[model samples]
Target chain A: MTAEFWNGTMAAAAAAKQARVQVNAAYPITPQTHTVEYLSRFVNDGELDARLCKVESEHSALSACAGAAAVGARAFTASCSQGLALMSEVMYFTSGMRFPVVMAVANRTLSVPVNIWADHQDTLVNRDAGWIQIYTQTVQEIYDLILLAFRIAEHEDVCLPALVAYDGFILSHASEPVHPLDQAAVDAFLPPPGSADRPLLDPARPLQFGEVLFPDWYPDFELKKHRALADSLGTIRKAFEEFEAASGRRYAPVDAFATDGAEMVIVGLGSMMKTARHTAEKLREDGVRVGTAALRVFRPFPAEDLLEAVGGCRTVLVLDRDIGYGTGGMVYPDVTRILYHEDHRPDVLNFIVGTGGKDITPATIERCVELARGGYRGRVEFWPDARGAEEGVPYTEEPAAP
Target chain B: MPNTHPESASASAGRKLHEIRLAGRGGQGVVTAGDLLGKAAVREGFWAQSIPTFGPERRGALSSATLRMGPEEILLKCSTAAPGVLLVLDPTIWTQFNVTAGLVEEAVLVFNTTEAPEEVEARLRGGALPYRLGVERCRICTVDATGIALAVLGRAITNTAMMGAFCGATGLLGLEPVEAVLAERFGKRASPNIEAARAARDAIRWRA
Candidate 1:
């Protein structure tokens, strides 16, 4: 297969095309609009044999996808921050129903003043929801991960929906190289939806989805779902290994770079990981041993491996895009608890970087290292960013071009 | 200390990574210019990446796009604070913000004005805001890009014209790649933009 230049959104749509997604029921939003538009163009041009439901809202978009998937169709949908929030009600429901609906989430910052930019806040809001969440850094990762998403989500042992997220404009808009997968290879790697494994809403064998249950039965169901989620971690690893064999792109639950024999490890997720990884290499020349760990699978929450990646290091600096509001960065607590058992745990530093479309430069990374060397004072640091003084969405007299 | 440029350390001839920052308002096709330039770079057998400053994407609002191209893989990813080359689609964008805020000491500045480079620099010097950009070290090139865009595209979208000036100033990409990329980007509507690009590329000249 030939390598092509594509932004994250374009790569995702292209991957979805090769994966033979039968239904793309979506509401277009900034950062995510290109994806559905691509699918629409593909369908209109007769290149792709698929159905594109032009739904009005993200809520309806997901609902329509859920409906299509219930009837045993390969379904997909995508959205950004507020759109994710709007569709979150259905997000939980789709997972609870155990529909293998693969969704691509372009991570965006939440809105009090309507900032449509990159952040993990949107993707992590419903982390506890039964869906398997996978985050990607580059355009290639977005393409490969979405292809692997369907296989992981449809595993008989783990028939849960999946959400694949990448930074909104950083990756979604930023163009990079991605190797296109041949449809034959993808088709062979991923079976035909595996709809027969579970009871489908067929005309002959009709079953109700999202059924009401008694409190006593509901607890058992929730417990079973938790067990399935824990079990899906194994399936996720297997899927990644299989994907590697099939596609030659090795994906791990956590992408570790130069972690072995490192003194400091910078941990992050999504596009920021690329920054930390590259910056770590540069800092290594100055005799500062810095490693990087990017969490690829957030929902399965690769705790054991994450600890292993940071265990040899003397200090751990976390760059989280999601702010936990009064609690500090959201990833801090999730990661800090991993180091709790040690007699003398390495100093864990938390800094909020690249929030609300702010650029994460090498200087901010260097500053993080400096702060880490000084030892964390139990405070969350927000990097200096371009937060436009005047709030509200910038409005202009001229309209946006198509 | 201000480490925000999209480029890493300047490329060692064989490993050269050229960086360009396009500055203008939202409506001026600034983002598209960066994207097309990157595409052209890729066509010329180099790795290229482009990222636009995305936000409340309203027309006439301040907008910038960063394009980085190199013989090898370009890893440095950040908004270009200082680029090797700077192209501003609007002559008066300096009035709103210092278009040369983090310009490299010896960077090349290409403007979309009909006036000569000296007149443009004088106007910049004589503006209400104090000039903080590099003085006497940088080279200033002038192109009547708005005029060319109006003549060719029937509008003042000077992005392609400025891109042509970038090629002429840097020589990183030639006339062929620029025209090819424009055709691919605009499809049937490319003729005018290509025409505008050729005129800018030919007429781009710096002050003595």
Candidate 2:
């Protein structure tokens, strides 16, 4: 198999083609426009048999995808920061109805100042939408996970929508060598769209998808949705296992790197995992017991896997790209929720870095680990130095000493 | 650095394509240099990849680009440490950052400066460094590119002139193939840029 280096934009389009999408709907935005442009080319060249729906807004894009998927057609769409927010209302419907639509969210900073760099605040803001979210760290993973997302979302036990996200401009524009599967192999791997047993608009069996429920049935419906989401955990793992067996590239909900007998651990999502791994290697060489874990699957939370991975560690640092306003960070609260139930939880620390594509280097990771090990117990600590503001001076401030 | 021997016909057949690094202040055509090299490599029937590293503050800050080429495919995506060729568009970058910290022992260093090669070599003593051309040639090429861009595309983009210098220095790909690529890349304005690129190719002088 000949290896070809593809820019992330091209790789994404190639993956979409491999998924054999029946429809593609998107709105143009910076850093993400390139991917859609490639999709347009693919559609025009007949490489992909799909309807390229040029919508006026991201809301209509996802809505069109939902409508298509509800009618038993495989559907795909993509969006970023403001676009994601614009589609927030329909985003919940897609997941609640269990449409099995896959979306590639180019992660970007949500705005007031109108920034277009990479960040997780956009996707993280949609956490309660009931969508299964998977964050990718590299261009290769971006290609691989799109295929996996379709399978995972369509699984009978996990009939839920899925979002595969990667940092905009960071991974989306970065070029790297990726091994693209042949068309035959991809066709063999993804079977043709199986009969959607639960179609929204079946003439023979009419059912209400998003009906206004009375007070009595509304709580039960919501509980059922929660139960369905919880049941998806098993299906998610099985899909990952099958993908690994076929492709020979293994992926897990939570990936731990160099965490053997480590006293301290750092947890992050998206591209920061790469920085963390590099930092972990450097720290291990210097004889510091530090390890890094990246949560590939954010929704369905993977509570058990996360607890098992961080168990017995003296300290655990939770770094989140999104902040929950006055309450530290988003992942920090979730990690604490899981730790609260455990009999023995490691000293959980939360640090916010890489917000709005602030440069997070290996040295910043090292500094984060040092702070966590030094008994810093504040709710949230920000790595201002990681922005490369002050040079040549190290550890200038004490970080409020708590 | 000196050319020990003329490049063999098949020298680059299996020897992985050389990795080149270009460093300069923002808006100095550093990224353009990498893009031109990539386009030319692709035209020569080789795979190429280019990436830019820029800071938040867009202008006047240090920006760099890396270009990799090879027969099979290029995979090393990070910044090149030991680049085989280093093109410095701004001399100030040498002091502002450690741009020349790592270079292959036999690597050639090209700079846009009026300083004597001896002075440049003295500053880069730990490793062998050679100054091949000055900013005068680059400014001339830039002026030509602006004229071509304005006349052809109604916008002055300096990337074409950098493409010309790359073609002149390396002889990696003929001007005809580059022009074809430029035509495919920039449809309506290919003719003027092709002429500008030819002028740039003719203007460059590689000093030993």
Candidate 3:
């Protein structure tokens, strides 16, 4: 196999080129800029046959991509931070329209003070936007998951737009060795788009798409959207299974590391999962009975798989990178919702760590596990400190003696 | 860290090349070093790739870049945990990160500072480090690079100086290939930076 090294941004663009994207609409934003720049280069170099659309804003970018996908062309776009928040309205519309467009989201902190660092707040702000969300922990996973996203989104049953998120700077900027799938292998796995005979939107078919409705028909439309979203879980699983068979890389909605027979388990998504994994290994060495489960796919919340992953554990620490303001962490509420009806569930605790690109080091992760072991049963526990002071706080001691 | 070589005869028969990791604050040309190294390697007819890591903000944050070169296509796509060459542009990295955690025994460590190798080695007391190179008067190189950029390319960029230091230190790819790569990278502004790179190359001294 021909090997080439790529940063996270280049890798995503390369995969999109290989996928033979038909349309690309993007708004220029930091951290996310390289992905678009490389795609533009691919188009300029004639490596990709695609229409590159430069939009006025992030909202316009998604709108253009959705419009292109509605015409049954494989469309792509990306944005982060405030850009994602700006496109929140169209995000819902794109999914409800079943456009199957794929986008990369460099997970960045949403801000009133304008911070540009890694956090889940931007994407977490619109968790109900009717899109499939997958968080990646490594650059390799970022490349692999983007490829899987197209398959999952375009599945006949799913037919929803997908957003694959990697932590801004942490994963997006972190240089890592990624085994890019060979073009021949990728072509064999994902064949060229079948005949566009199945028109999602055709003037000849004369069908109404995304028509506004009053309270009278809105309930039925809402029900239909809900059903379609619920139907996506099976489609996601099947797609992942097929991808694993082809690529030899397995994925799950919730991936557990060293969770078997553990007394306490930490749940996280994106790059923090890498930290948690390392912490778990260290904790296990210390005989703390700690483990980690990363939620790979978060949209159609993998309740069954997540519950099963943490089934026998006594304490469950759900570490969220984004908070829900006065309420608590985002995933805490979701996990609570799942456990509310269950007969047996772990003592769920929430810890919000690493907001605004704060380093969530192994020490912090180990401390969270120690808290869980000490029987801290509070509904929410902001990690290290509640007010995000753990951010900007220097390490207690230098890593290397000065 | 031990290098793992496949037992198969076919894999063992080929010549092994080098991989380098450069770490520093953002805007320090850490990424540029990797790019120049890759370009220079390509000029020498070897496969090369450069990968950069940084946050959204432009400056005052941890940034790193990696360069991998080999005769055969390199398959591993992970960070250089056990880097064969570690180049630190900012001394703050020694305190900020576990930078030396997985350096291989025969690795080379290069830093841009006035501190003697013995002083830096003493600072790394408990830790067994690789070989060291101190590019004293590195700021002069940076200044020269800026001056050359203005005189030739009409912009102040330090990428050339860092590239020069890399070429001077490693000599993995000879000066001719590096100059060609520099010409390709900075086409209009090649002359002054070429001179600056050569001067910086001369400035680098390996610790005895």
Candidate 4:
């Protein structure tokens, strides 16, 4: 792998270009415009000879991808926030057809506030929509995962659409060191898309596609889709291991840092995991038994992996970017189900922080660990980070700038 | 603070961690300054990242960018609270932004004003005592960066000018890499920016 400094937007675009995507059904949205724009540049410059479908709306963008994917062509697209919401219908249909369409989503907030910033609400709202949800923290993961998504999505075991996502501006705009593999290496790793998988549309071998399913037959299709979603976990791990062997960098279902013999564990999705991990390191200096567990693979939820990672901690802090309104943090509900039945479980504190583009700071993570240590249970009430500072009067000794 | 990195006294020491937040009016090239600083850091074999704060900034509206650089990799994506260096491209930025907000110990605040150091401190420090500034071992430096940029580049963009001030105050790294990065990014048009940066470096003075 070639190492270089790349922001998320450039990494995503570069991956698509290197993968030599056959079709790009394009649409432009805040934070995500660069992905398609960059691909279009490559195509125009003769670096990538792909069909560029400059679609009208995000709806058309995904629809065009679905149409292309059905014809056994490697298709890719990207969207964010409102565009994602508009294309929600097609996102489900794309996966239902088992097209293995790959998408990169710069997770942003839904409107009412109408802000263009980083938030988890956008991806969280669609967690149940049959797309493999993978959240990345660094620029390296963003580039690597875009290539991996196609492999996992088109695998014979899991023929489904996948969304390789990251926090919108936080990662999409932030620059970091990335290991960009040679095009020949990437090409060897990922076969020309659809060369391995079967497709519905064929001119020589005529076949009907997406016909109305009878009530009895529909359940079978749904069950198969559900099974693929659950069973894809193994394929994801296998691909990660193979990737690690090729590149010196390793990946896993859940990345745990400083978790061994820890009393407190903080868990989250997207870029905040890095901040949480950094806080754990600082707290480690202070002799605090703190650790971090990041949900690298969100769709499969990595429940077993999370269980093993957090089993040693006495108190687990779940910092959520998307709140469940009346139920508290969105991610907490699923995590609760896993630990509730266990005989020995860490007391989990759910913090609904950093919603709608606010930053989750190391100070905030420290506060949560402190609260969890003090036997704080259920949803948290303190606003000790930059995001909270934006909503009201400063509450922490050091309110970080957002 | 054990975590704090000492300013470079040698080539090996040059990779010290530095977090700089630059604030200025919309047209002042604050974001461009962050980009240039990052490029220079990379050229010097350090990891540099900048996040430009985009908003409804028209001509003179507040535009700020946070820049982070270190010897090793930086993992955190959040904005810097306790910056090692706080750069104010415009003196008026002090009124709107808490320019001194989260300053680590021995932090440097480099101003691009033509005023004397003591006078700028008096105007910037409010009526509060020196300790009330909330920073211990804070070094305040001033330079006529705008004057240098205007004269050399024929524009009021003080990014390169203040960059020179940063290098002079911190003595962070050699100006060779900075000039080289400028040459690459700006091509043949880099001469004026390089001159502005060098002039700003020469014009800087520290407050007692």
TM-score of each: 0.90, 0.77, 0.76, 0.93
Q: What is the lDDT of residue A53 in candidate 3?
A: 92
Q: Residues A244-284, candidate 1: write the lDDT tens digits.
A: 99988898999999999889999888887887787888899
Ranking by TM-score: 4, 1, 2, 3
Q: Residue B153 deviation, candidate 1, in Å?
A: 3.3
CAPRI grade, predicted model 3: incorrect
What does candidate 4's lDDT look like per residue over B104-139, in tens digits? 877778888878878877765665432235675777
TM-score of decoy 2: 0.77
Q: Of the pair 1 and 4, which is ahead by DockQ?
A: 4
lDDT of 2 by residue, A162-214 (tens): 99998887677766567788787787677686455666677787877877889
The parts of candidate 1 lying over 4 Å away from their true place are: A194-196, A215-219, A342-344, A378-402, B1-14, B122-130
Candidate 3 recovers a fraction of native contacts equal to 0.06
| Clashing pairs for predicted structure model 4, backbone only | A2-A180, B82-B102
lDDT tens per residue, model 4, A37-130 = 8898898899998999978999999999999988888899999899999889988888788888899999888887778888888888888889
Off by over 4 Å in 2: A384-402, B1-21, B24-50, B54-63, B66-86, B89-109, B112-208
Clashing pairs in 3: A173-B53, A177-B77, A177-B78, A178-B77
lDDT per model vs. reference: 0.81, 0.72, 0.72, 0.80
Q: Which candidate wins on TM-score?
A: 4
- Candidate 3 lDDT over A319-372, as tens digits, reads 999988888789888887887787777788988887887666665677677766
Scored against the native two-chain complex, candidate 3 gets a DockQ of 0.13
lDDT per residue (tens digit) for residues B3-114 in model 1: 1112323234237666678889999999888888888877777788888877677888888888888877766666765677788898777666767766677677888877
- The DockQ values of the predictions, listed in order, are 0.31, 0.14, 0.13, 0.49
Pairs clashing within candidate 1: none
